[model samples]
Target: MENGSRISGDRRPQVGVAVFLLKSSSILLGRRLSSVGYGTFALPGGRLEFGESFEECARREVKEETGMDVVRVEILTVVNMVALDGPDPTHFVTIIARAEMADSGQSPANMEPDKCAGWAWYEWAQLPQPLFGPLEDLLKGGFNPFAASRLM
Candidate 1:
């Protein structure tokens, strides 16, 4: 792989979204309930639905998964993850964006707080682990909102 990046399995080409919602000095993170990365905490986002723009998808996903409306969206990083070990190798482009908070706080609707669990806003420098995969790198890289360059 170029740049020394590695893909572990046969995964299919898919487009996904990720949002880094910030309020006060913390960023929002949601625990996965349904998906390949279930039980792990990840940014609030999902696949882009047909006919929806990437930004729209990001906004909608954040609301659906965390109940917190997105006030503004800004692109932070783009991650391309690949898996080459299955029937059909997969490639995913995860567009990571920063979302400003629109409400005080909220939780997933109709889901058990302990199952879908609850979302948390943590200090950037003290984020908990098991934070999906791509996000872990972004969070650990000292990403600054005003920075011109993104971490590779």
Candidate 2:
């Protein structure tokens, strides 16, 4: 890990990460407080640091934001997010992954109150409205994170 040091190239598209933490039949979701996607539902992840792989980013972000340890970090898919609809166009090549808690009894907490309002589990079909940009694109593409039957 690069101690949360984000990548440098001025022109390189920023790398974002999100985790699909499924417990039983529900997946974890958090409401964003940051400017990029304020008040929208988002996965528990942050920017990938320099020299840090996507798996490391996911694990670290989950632990930091939810105070829970996760295992089985596997890449679900990648989304090329181009925010063309907004005035301030943004592009993030988000790497999405799936993970599970080490212990089922352990629940999530809002460790970073400034970045997220809180954490909760929601059914896939009943996800909250106004998801973060990358997540919105993922849902629109019909990318089901829980379905292990599909080949990514």
Candidate 3:
């Protein structure tokens, strides 16, 4: 936990981006590849690089994690998970982005095979059970940015 300090005790803060790609009215879900939450179903996203803008990081992470290029990006919501794991724990900034999938037809690329086991597309009403944190938030209307931010 460096800038804006989120961690309380000895726990380190992690930064990650979560993208909600809309295709044919369905959102894409990628299986968690590595162990922080391996085998779990989640959105296409990852940690931010040093000095990177949140928007840029979100776009790059989504492409790398899901192999699908994003044609457009709109900030959906921002979740501060620094205090989610009790008073002293791991922290994370989950930036939810609404993205349009490109027509790249690229397979998941540069992925950590050991981390993610699978990937698929699902309708909002048909998403698999036990949705990951970010996805859960999205479905619960947590990512309603324009309204959430009072922009609309």
What is the alpha-carbon RMSD of candidate 1 to the true structure?
A: 5.1
The predicted structure with the larger TM-score, 2 or 3, is 2
For each candidate, give its TM-score against the true structure.
0.73, 0.87, 0.74
Clashing residue pairs, backbone N/CA/C < 3 A, model 1: 9-83, 9-84, 9-85, 10-85, 10-86, 11-89, 11-90, 12-90
Q: Model 1, residue 92: what's the lDDT?
A: 74
lDDT of 1 by residue, 1-152 (tens): 46654554453578888887766777777676655556777877878888987778988987777666777677768877765544445567888777676765554352345445677777866777677766766556765543424332
**Clashes in predicted model 3:** 3
lDDT by residue for model 2 (22-115), tens: 9777889999998889999999998999999888999999999999999878887888876644445567898889988989899899999999
Q: Which has the better TM-score: candidate 1, or candidate 3?
A: 3
- Superposed by TM-score, candidate 3 places the C-alpha of residue 113 at a distance from the truth, in angstroms, of 1.8
Model 1: lowest-lDDT 10 consecutive positions: 143-152
lDDT of 2: 0.85
Q: Looking at candidate 2, what is the lDDT of residue 82?
A: 61
lDDT of each: 0.69, 0.85, 0.66
lDDT of 1: 0.69
Ranking by TM-score: 2, 3, 1
By how many angstroms RMSD does model 2 differ from the true structure? 6.6
